[model samples]
Target chain A: MAQAPVTTRGRGGRAGTWYLFLVPALLLYSLFVVYPLLTGLSYSVFSWKGTVRDAFVGVDNYVGLFTNEAFRSKLLPALGHNLALFAGTMLVQNTMGLAFALAFSRARRGKRALQIIFATPYLVNPLVIGYLWTLLLSPTFGPANTLLRAIGPDELAKPWLGDPSTALPMVILITTWQWVGFPMLLFSAAIGGIPAEYAEAARVDGASSWRVFWHITLPLLRPAIGTITVLSFIGSMNTFALVYALGGSSGGPAGSTDVLGLLFYRAAFASGDINAVGTASALAVFLFTFIFGTTILLNRILRQGEEAM
Target chain B: MTPRRGAVMVPLMLWGYALVAMIPLFVMVLGSLRPTQDLFNDPIGLPNKLYLSNYTRAWTEASFSTYVLNSVVVVTGAVILGAAVSVLAAYPLGRRKFTGRGFFIGYFISGMTLPGHFGVLPLFYLLDGLNLVDSRLGLMLVYAAGSVPFNVFVLSAFFRQLPGELDEAAALDGAGPFATFRHIMLPLVRPAIATVVVFQFVPLWNDFFYPLVLLRDESKLTIPVGLTHFFGRFQNDWGTLFAGLVMTTLPLVILFGIATRQIVAGLTAGMNR
Candidate 1:
């Protein structure tokens, strides 16, 4: 029934020729990705200062991440920020994305144009998005403030990125602004893929639009929701470039906007300390474990959710 | 909500968000056209005239010419190399049943979760030891290599979905694996290939992180890094900064405009996978 017989014959006869197809990618991926990952793991175990190996420190860097005051101040709060970002993205961004996707799913006129316009932001550079938002949110010269003042919300036009209290939320919003289109696109596709008959049949029974959506559409969209949830969760946890571009390496405004990615970068590159890279490797390992574990768990949960339904 | 209310609200909400998404872009374009003094004075006002000096200033004064060239070269090179390598790898893994196939698939898929930032420092050291630091070629290699996992993942899925009869038929004929891949199987997955191409193009073009870390030479800087430097040097010159920002973004916007359908389909394909 399958290609098992032919594949076995072909495999034994042309093993060398077949593997040649795999060589280029495997070689490059191993050298570029796997090698560096292993090297990072090895580096994490040693104490290095300024690119020089100082001593063999076994899990001391990992342990110190919890015990050390400076590391704790940096890492713990950054972890909190990541959780906050994950929540914001999953709640607000996913909600907004779903709303837009729902809107577009029923849209007839200007559907293509709206999708293009909304998804256009995702096409541009994240660094540029950061700077663009910075300009738009600039305290004195930005258009947002100008419009705010003109609209009689003069006091509401605060420095969006300057105040520590507002900085992380602003970062989260900007990140969402740039990427919300992606989830929307995904959800749009998922919704579009559903047969029209399901909703039509419900409507024929005098189901309200909301009722139809709640009972019929929502269950069908569970897979998409799971995918978006996991993707957004991982994406937010690894948020670095946007934060780097917008909040700077220090994750400024008193590190309120600091996430684990930025903290890892600061530990590796920005800090003038010689032993920081080793510490950074420990952070990387922690992040890898966290991300890998979370992704697997989410995938399992999503599968379970699908199976249960 | 009533069906009437829902129908009216759907388009209204979509159009409203579309306008919101575009306002910053329109503002940037208009601001780029206004003189610095005019932007400072009328931040929200339309440009009175098509002032072209800001663009000229950005093009030459900010070294965007070099940056744009570097960006194009790197993005193009990475897409071509990445697509080729992944197609080659995916053909076997997706179409053929073989020993260690599951292990190999797992190996490639492992990268999807592991953030590139994890091993980037060691990658930096590795590249430096190889004397590839501050080189566009080095940056291109990293981009292409990093793209393999994603490219392979998507392409292999696509390849598997193609009917196996084509491969068997080709095999029944005098066609070898390479010939069959190049002739029959490859053509069947052209859309997937295009999807991979379109998908990788935008991200690689816009990526600032690897270019930031791997590249140090001023001449080799991509648009994002270049624009950041331009921003730092000319923060007060909002006109030129806006112009630089527009220049940095215009290619992508134009690309999106031209290939909106393909881009949308490609994005949806990945998400639904």
Candidate 2:
């Protein structure tokens, strides 16, 4: 890893060619990714509507995003829904994912078929998946209602996506269904990478299965857990297409399924009022800050938890 | 984590979840084969006769044919443009010890963290100003640009794994840097390039956001966007809708079935290692 002397570079003149190689990617990335981000930050301050800048309103847009009643009622609850998604998925999906990983790691029967079948859902488009679930969960003609009725739980066969009380939970479960394989695979890889010797040694010491998992396996899987948490958390926070496809931009079923991404879209595009652009930009900035800050905070907390263990 | 001695519940649980995953897909396929009335009455049952009219209706009346063609074009364009650029960029970053190499690598990896909503409005204006709005080429550009960071990130890592001796040998034989990349280095990293393509292809084909915002023309819509419009019009036709979903998703399902290992490895490549 030692650096070669700078004199080596001066004689070669290959540095120019190296920069040539970097330019295409650098230019494309800056144009689409970096430049737009910086532009969005600046646009959050001004009273602009699409292309026209009206005035330098300073931080008024940010202030309005908080103080405005319409924005508040939608934004705050939408954020809550996102948190609900994160919590629900963590409890159900990750737990299932870990269980599947453990099962696949141990089971001798149908492992490959199970892996392929489990992972298939993650391969399709999220929008398509949302639409498919919308059909499956339809109250009148959907199979879910039929199955529930057949199982003697006729009361359980309600309009899953149409009722405000159930819409968010249904959407959350659908989201979990699409992505459980991701965490399963991630945990499987991490679990697979654990040295067999460590587990063998623990077993030789007469450690019970439950005690071994609690003491050795879970602690060693801290990094994987941390990764899945941060990823699943932020992913839910920024989710758009699933809710948009299933519930529409208004976060339908009377906005029970409302999320920040849909809120941003409704603010920016659905309202048709141009001045809402600045407010939407402000919301975007808030979302960016929240995602970035929480990622850093969660990673730090996970690191500390690892150290404590 | 070791496999514990108590294995019965975990395996049963895994199989149960696997069934949960497969059942919906099974329903989708089965429902697609029935007429609308049959599906309405007997959604969970197998079709009495395989009705093929729903596929034709979805293809012709729903206009998924045009959408599929458009998606194929955009996905092909974006994957090729992105892969070519990534190869060129990853080569220098991975092979040479240039000034600002770390900075360049960091610059590319940073794209992974960007939120989609953050700059979408600004990007809309940017594309509009450039007069690329409502055009396939414009959408392709956005797709290619958006994909560059991850492609460069993955490909550069793959490129770095090549032995330095190969580059030295190529240079010793009077292969210029460009020639070394085009002839010597590119062949060694074909698998990574395929990884980049497979990774990029699914998202691009599945993309609805860019086409929703940028392409206003009906002729230019991708499958996701196109299907939404079709669904809105034929909201009551459950059979046709199911057929449309199957056709739209079948290619990916087939691809995954054929290359499950490659797709999974390509996807989880950076996550673990």
Candidate 3:
């Protein structure tokens, strides 16, 4: 389409009104987002006691984040937990989500109900999801334990969230259950978009269903897979409300479910001191850099994969 | 991908997963309906009788009524503020071919995927300095700002797709740019705006982190944050909490059920299309 010439937009001076239209959203967005982003960078290098900055600390806060025992202990483990959560989603969320998507796309009946059912868990607050699951997984007066006891041994009904080893995994599964709907919808739509001819032709060639899925369906889903992977990575990394609800702000049961967002909260607000603010700011900056860089790298890889396909 | 033939196991697996997935929610509904005593005494058994008191208790004693009101107010305000500004901004970028148009579009688009949580400290201080930290209007502003990127992104793309004859026809009819936009263009983009709102509603409604840290007053808190405090206060009232949870989630579920097709379309709008 040819560009609409400027003079055609208005009789004479009215063309400038477009700039007027841009101001409200731009001002709100800039003041809230662009400005703080810059300030966050500067704040990372300075000590702040609540709203007041006390001293400039160069890279000391960043250094301290990696060195200070107070943060170092939590930071590494939190990072590990984030990665573990990502891995778990890659396993559980991806596989189940794809299966659900495939099934939904194939089924001739109740597609609307299936979509709604799959989508319900994700519609509520993650915090609420955490709370609901907490009640379900409660050792006493919880149906999950009762069912486990009746179906298996009494030992099978052990506290799900109370134990350290199980806490993180439980959180991961709950996270998966809450989020799988969205990616599933995406996958289902993508699968639906694929022309049936490719798979039909493959079937005519006597290819097994697995063979057709592997070569035709999976290859066609490369973009969706890449997009979901990147999004899931970011989602897991930024997770806080779920962890905060299931485990306390400390990410407890022994800090087994601790993650970067919680660590940021704990560091920033724990003392409300100037140095703590600086340290938290430093961590934020680091997280920003890490996430931004990795996403760029991932985008590049995705583009390359698409081109290769 | 469709296979000509499939095993019975596939449908069985799907149905099994669906049933298992519904268990937690079913349990929540049952817990809400039955008495707390029944919940504890007959953990795995049927409810002896229906007890509607849990909903009333949660509504009155737990203060979820006020919290829901606050949530509705904030979410509606944010959606309006976000949508209004986005529509205005998108028109200029989408319809006009002025200088630095690309720059402005790029600026809004840059924030599309950047999570704004990392700037909490700075943002808090920014709002505090502006005296907006604990205010409802402040929360609305923050939510609005957070949504601008996505709203502008989608809305602008929508605006760009309109036929150029629209502007020409409006211009010939002696309508100025603003008048044209208000009368002609606005009516056309209603579906896109609705789509944006539907897409924005879920995240905005479900957001907990920002409201928790930003708002301080008890009555001012939204449902998610308020529910946490309610849980703390009524630690052992599992039935009441379940009622609160159902109250919080049920309306949304019902809404989605009614508008399932539109919601699904809005959600999958970013996919292969």
Give the top-scoring candidate (lDDT). 1
Question: Which digits, one per residue and each the tens of the lDDT, describe model 3 over residues B16-83?
Answer: 77776677888888889888877888776655687899999999888888988998899989988999
Q: What lDDT does each candidate get?
A: 0.86, 0.84, 0.85
Instruction: Give each model's clash number.
Output: 2, 0, 1
lDDT of 2 by residue, B1-273 (tens): 344535667777777888899899889898889999988878688988869999999999989899999989988998999889888999877766767889988888888767654788888889888998888888888889889888888888888788767767666687777887788888999988988888788778887777877887888888888988988988899999989999989988787767666676676776654
lDDT of 2 by residue, A185-245 (tens): 8899899999878878988999877787788888899999999999998888878888888
Please report, as a residue range, the 10-residue window in candidate 2 chain A with the lowest summed lDDT.
A1-10
DockQ of each: 0.56, 0.55, 0.55
When sorted by DockQ, best at the front, the candidate numbers are 1, 2, 3
Q: Please report the TM-score between candidate 3 and the true structure.
A: 0.92
Cα misplacement distance, residue A147 of candidate 3 (Å)? 0.9
Which sections of candidate 2 miss by over 4 Å? A1-14, A193-212, B1-10, B167-173
Instruction: Please identify model 3 stretches exceeding 4 Å from their true place.
Output: A1-6, A9-12, A102-112, A193-217, A302-309, B1-6, B258-262
Q: Per-residue lDDT for B148-229 in model 1, tens only?
A: 9988998998988887677777777878889988999888888887878877898898887788778878898998888778
